[model samples]
Every structure is written in C-alpha cells, then in structure tokens.
Target: MHVQGVDGAEESNDGSFVDLRRSQAGAFTRTQAMRCGISDKVLGRGVRARQLQRIHPGVYVDFTGPLPWETRVWCALLACGPGTALTGPTALRKYGVDGDWRDDRIHLAVPHTRRLDRKSSVVVSRHRDLPAILHRTRRPLTVRIEVALLLTAGAHRDVSRRAAVLLDACRQRRTTPHRILAELPALPSLAGRSTLRRILADASDGVQSFLEHAYLRRVERAHGLPHARRQVRATTEQGVVYRDTEYEPYGVIVELDGQAGHADSISRWRDMTRDNAAATSGKVTLRFGYQLVSDPCSAAIQVAAALQHRGWPGRPRRCSPACRL
Candidate 1:
C-alpha cells in the first residue's frame, strides 16, 4: 500500500523523505517513515549507510550533530507511543517558569492504563484523566500551566523548590491564582493539594517569593492572624513601592526580607525611604528576615501584638501545642 509521505507530492516522495527528516530535528520512527511511504528497505539502507542512527528500538536520529535537548523531548514523546504529551517542568520551562530546575529525563504524561517501559532519557507520568488535564498549545501537545505546576510540585523533592514553582509560574507566566484555583476541582490526582491550595491562596493575596509565601502560611494563616492585603502599592518620591503584606485597617505593613541582604547603599536608601514614607502615612511597618520567617511562632506573636496594639480585639490562637500564644 502506498503511504502518505511527509510532503503531499506523490512522485517526489524521495525528496519529501529528506524534508521530513530535517523537519523533525533529524529524528523519526520506523512507523513514521513507513507512514510517509518510506519502505523498510530504505530505512535499513539509511541506517547501514550511517545516515541514520538508531536511538531507540524503533526511533532513529539523523547523525547531523549533537541532539538538542528539545529534540530529545520530541524523541521521548515519540518513543512513549501515542496519547502522550509533555508535562511538569518540561512543559513549564517552555512557558519561561523555573529556569533553575534541570532534569535529564523528559517528563511525559500518558493515559493511566497505557503501560510503558521507562527510557533512560524519559520519565513517564501516568494520568488517569489525562484528557481533562492536557491543554492544547501551539505545540499541540502540552499540559496546562496549572497542571504543569501541580505536577512539578509533586515531582520536585525540595520544599523551597515546590513553593517557588507556584510563585514563579504565576509571576513569570502572568497566570492568575484564580485561574490555577479553578483547575483544582477538575484535577483527578493531586500529590500535595493542601500545599498547592495554600500557595494559591498566598498568590491570590500577592505573595511573590518563597519566603513571603512561608510567612503567609506559617505566621499568618497558621495562627489565625488578621488577613492582610499583599503587595500593596503606594506612590513615593523615590519611586513606587509594594508592601509585601499590609494590615490596612490596623495600619501595619509586614515586609519579608529575602535571603539576599540589602547591603548595597542604594537599596538600603530606597528601603529606608520606603519605611519613612509608610511612617509618614501613619502606617507602622514590621520587617522580618529569613531567620524570623523560619520561626513562625515568634513572628505570629509579634504580629498579634502589633495588631492588638492597633486596637485589634481578637487574640491570636496557638497554631500548635508548643506554640505559646
């Protein structure tokens, strides 16, 4: 039976073979070649002639040069058989989120019942409800941004990395927390739903970094502190400033200092000026560093005191048995 070649032309099938090889990053499967009207004899001949390199049982790579990482992802998709698409960090990376994570194995999501052997360069994640989780992108085969972030949270081992994925995906991809939250009910299998929910809640409140997120979870939410407005913007002579978390009703602002210190003179001046501006506006600012954020109990106590001092009638409840409220 004559098969449809890469190019639509019939007589020029030979030329189309070459075009197809080049189009797919010099990688194709035996099935693809056969479907393209290329005979097994031609495939064998190409491999024997050193023009094609067998990268997997049925997959061949054109010996053009070093195979790019993206091409490898494509090859992994092909090798995983049909009904497979890129997911997790592999998909999120394309959306410009979490550049620091590097995994050698390409992440693919396939139907749950589709049993497949593992490949050295591929990691297969089975989703029982893949059809619901998958999203059609320009590539036509990728998990949605929220799905990718959720899967990534499961795949990553580090707590900070897990936390950062949510914040970074929202900030970098310009996706809203509400958009992510909307996907939760439809998600069939969730690895860390509570953590994801917390991150989404923090994101909705404008928590930006991992540390700030920790403060929101550990200090504020845990101890039942007053809900604070996050990333509150104010115009200042130095420039516009965003308060990390603000208790506007009580006129209290909480600033979370990152791991990196504001040692530079200009940054220090800007911070001082921002604090002065808040004070001038009759708002008191409470700043916490990495150490304080780590000790959530103490941070909550301080915040409770600050709110109470500002006429908050409610007392902060103990977050744990050991927490001295």
Candidate 2:
C-alpha cells in the first residue's frame, strides 16, 4: 500500500520531494520520502537504477560515490529520527570552531526519554534538556554553540582536554566565556563543572589557549608570581603584535609557543624578528614551548628570575615538594 502524502497530494505535483532533498544535502529518510507520496517500489526502482544510495537502512542520498561531509551529517540526523541535534565536536564544527575538533563519528543528542537504534558512524546521546539547547530555526538542527562547548567539554575525561575545548571555542571567536557561563546552570551535572568554571573565568581574563591557562594557573598563581597581563597589545617594528603574557611594569614578556615547532621558515623568521624588535625596545622576551611549560615550577622560576632581574623584589615560591623554586 502507498503511504499517504503529507499534504494529501503527491510530492511530484507539489515539488516538496525535491525541496526536502535539497534542504537535507540530497539525503532523505525513507519515511520522509513516503510522507512525500513516494512508494517503497519507487525507492527500490531508484536504488536499482543507481539514482539513490542507501546510507543507513532507511536513509538514502540521491548521489552515489563517497558521501560528502554534509550528506553524512544529514544521514545521521535522518537515521536518528526527529528532535535529534548535532552535539559535541560535530556541533562546534558547524558553529565554525577551528582546529582539531573534527570527529569521524557524527555526534547527536535526543530527548532523554527517547530510545533510538544505533547507526554506523553515529554517536547518539540522551539529554534531559535537549529541547532547550537545540537551535530549532537552524537547518540540520544543532545545539547552540554554548551548549555544544559545554557538552564537548564534558565528554573529555582529562581536565586539560576539557579546557582545550572551551578555550578553543572562545579563541576562535565561535563563542564567548560569558555565553558558555550562562548555559552552565542547565547542565549542573556536567563533568568537571568546577574546573570548567575556573577555565571560563580564565578565558574571561583573556587566557585564550590551554597552554595560556596552564601558564596562568600552574606557573604564575602557584608560584606566587604577579598576574601577567594576557593578550597584551604592543606596537612594534613588526607592526602590531599581541604578547601572550606581559609584565609591563617589569618590562618582561612571556611568549607561549603552542606549535610543535616553528611551522615553517617564515614562522621562524617572523618569531625571530618579533623577539629582536622587543629587544630593541628594551623588553625581555622569554619563550616557552609545551615541553617547558609542562614543568610549571621550572617555567615559573625562569619567569620569576626575569621579573626579579627587571627590578621586582619578589622571589618565586615553591609550588610543591618537588618544586626547585
């Protein structure tokens, strides 16, 4: 028996079928096609004719070959049924968060009360407040960037990894610490809530990366070093440059190099030129990489030494039993 059309008219007469397919990146659920007045026999014919590609059981795409990222996303949503939204890193990427947030599996969230079957390359989660977090007006349906950040952050077991998610979201200008802070009350049971709050506070203070957050907490605060100004803007021969951490009164600047290395010869030269310009302006630049920052005590010692040499009277305090400072 043919499924009844949604508007009591065949999709062919109304053009809803084509419109629905286009809106979902050429992917549509079998149920969706049926609601548009397409039959099982018609779908079988389309599949046999190589005009439709089955993605996940009921999900079908108009094109064959490798599926595009957008098509994969649509297929996941269609397979999950209604009220499902893109969540975690998948949602963050949709909101334009740059860097390493991409996932091979499409992450989705539905209302906690609904139980859905699993699909390949799809991770489905249940959220009690899914409706509140979901962006209803947006296509492909996604959780708000703030909620997505929190969800993504909560999924990580490591505190640093969680901090990285929140920081990268803000650093890339996809979301703000304040917006994320506003969404925190909705997820009171989120993992590492206290740590998440602290990181958000640090982000509000212009700490833009996990490395910067680590430096602020482990090195500066732990060692009783003066709080350094973060993202300090300075006009130099290289034009405008922002220093990661600046002790302006002490004439000392700390540059946290998060890159594995100078990415290229141009990056190396740019760094060298910036340091030289700082030197010419009588400012001392202390560079620290991930390895150096891993030992917070050592990093603090160096920073404290630089501050002391620039006429600060304070000495670095030992943070732990193993701390050499």
Candidate 3:
C-alpha cells in the first residue's frame, strides 16, 4: 500500500515500507520507515533478509549493492535528523561548484542548540541562526549555494585558497559577486570577515583567478595603478583570445599564465601566436606568471612604464615603505 507524509515523501509500490529511499538516494531513517507503516518486527525482518543494510544507528540503505558517494551523504543527512542540511563542499558540489570533494566524509549543519549522534563518516557542525529557506526550497535538505561557499570559506585559513574556492564557485554557478556580498553580513562567522571583504571587493573589480586577483590587490589597487579591463576578448586569426587584463585605450594586454595552462608546447605556441597577433594589431602585450603575481611590485613598475609609453600619463604609486614604483 502506498502512503504519503505531510513532507511529501511517498512510498514505492513494492511494499518497501519507507518510500523515502527513492528520493533520498536509496537511504531512509527508522523514523521515516515507521511513519511509512514499517513496524520494528518488519524492519528486523528486512535486515535479516538483506533487503536493508544498516549504515547508521537508525539509517539503512534499501539496496545491498555497493553504495555511491552521494548515497553515503544522503545516509548521513538522514541520520542527523531534521533541521540538518548538507553544507560546505557537499552542498557546493550539488550546485555544480568546483572544489576538493575527495574528503571521504559528509558535512552537515544543524542548529547550534540541537545535538546529534557522532558518526565517523559524518561531520556534524552546529550553526546559530541556520537559514530556514536553505532547506525549505526545492533543493531540500541542503544549504543554498552561497551559504555553502561561505561556509567553505570559513573553514579555509589560506586567503588565496579561500579566494579560489569562492571565485570558482561564482564562476561555475554564474552567481553574482554582489549577491554573495549582500549575504555576507547574515552568514555565520567562519572566514575572517576583513579578508573575505577584501577578496570580494577585488572580485567585484573583475579579478577572475588567484593570480589575477593578487595582481589587482597587491599591484594595481595597492599601488594605485589604473584599473584595467579584465578578461577582454579579441578576435584574431586563431579565432578569439582572452586577455587576462587589458587597457584598451593604451592597447596594453596583460596575460596571466598559470603553469597548468601554459606548460604544454601547444599552449605555449598558441600564447606566442596570440601575442604576435596582438603586436601586429598595434597592441603591446605583457605576460605575467605565478612568480610575478607572487611578488608583483617589479611587474607593476614595468607595466606602469609600458602604459606611460603608450600615453597613459599616469605613474604607479609605491605600495609600501622601501618599495619602488
């Protein structure tokens, strides 16, 4: 007999008792099973028959085959009880946000006032003022994308890595930096507020990568250089090429070459071809790498000089004491 709950969970026709398994990735809790008309006797019967496998104290997988990573996550959430939602990398992954997901454990956020059983594969975090809509929306039992990113940011101490995670989340999900900034005040304190605020400001200024962002913060903004247009696309014989940063009025193109993309011969050749094309078009190209982005003062001075030669009429300011611009 098919049954339904007020929460909209339904049962399958095969008399599995708990239909939550279908929606919950083949995992369900004892409370949900009982709510779907499964008695303790029947539950024990299913366990004995191998139709159900206990994963947590009160959670079971409806199937016997090897469980996938997502199923394990689902099992963790179900075991954590209500008012809990996936957070951090787990929730971010659901939103198609890129990050490290091989941690082999699930992260769930519950109300700070509530307590849950400790499980080795599950990390239960307590949050004050857990946003209600994160779990109430169509993407039930999981935090929102921005919330997940914010939470993930709070866990990371390295500023560059944190910026990469947040920026990549924005890039992959096509979420606006303004939306993230607007929500920053309401989020629980995890990341350093001042640092996050700085990164977001740089992001709003059109910095896209860790390197590009560093150049903006440490070189351009810090040294008072002209704000260059970012990720500018230009058409060439090789189709289209994207300049990392560009001063269109001065015809100065700055390319940030990360090792991963510029390491191969093919990539190097393409970069050279694009640089030559820019030169032919009367544009001056300047390329920077991780090292330049790391210690950007010298590179900033060179770019400043190039811009001056192209009639920029502005001098880059010194960023710190004992530093030359």
CA lDDT, every prediction? Answer: 0.78, 0.84, 0.77
lDDT per residue for candidate 1 within 1-325, as digits (tens), equals 1222333422244556556666667677888777666777876776777666677789877674567877787688778888888887788876667556767668888998998876887888888788887776546388888878777876567767777888877767557788888888867567777878877887877888888888887899899998888888899877899888899999998988774548687777777888999999898988998876557898898899999999888888888999977
In candidate 2, which residue ranges exceed 4 Å CA deviation? 1-16
The TM-score, computed over Cα atoms with residue i paired to residue i, of candidate 3 is 0.83
Compared with the true structure, what per-residue lDDT tens digits does model 2 show for residues 248-306?
99999999887843888888887888888889989999998896556888898889999
Error of 2 at 153 (Å): 1.0
Better of 1 and 2 by TM-score: 2
Error of 2 at 91 (Å): 0.8
As for TM-score, the candidate ahead, 1 or 3, is 3
**181-265 in candidate 3: lDDT tens per residue?**
7768767465587787778777787777788888777877888888789878889988988888998999998888777667789
- Worst lDDT run of 10 residues, candidate 3, spans 1-10
Clashing pairs in 2: none
lDDT for predicted candidate 3 compared with the true structure: 0.77
Q: Is candidate 2 or candidate 3 better by TM-score?
A: 2
Index of the highest-lDDT prediction: 2
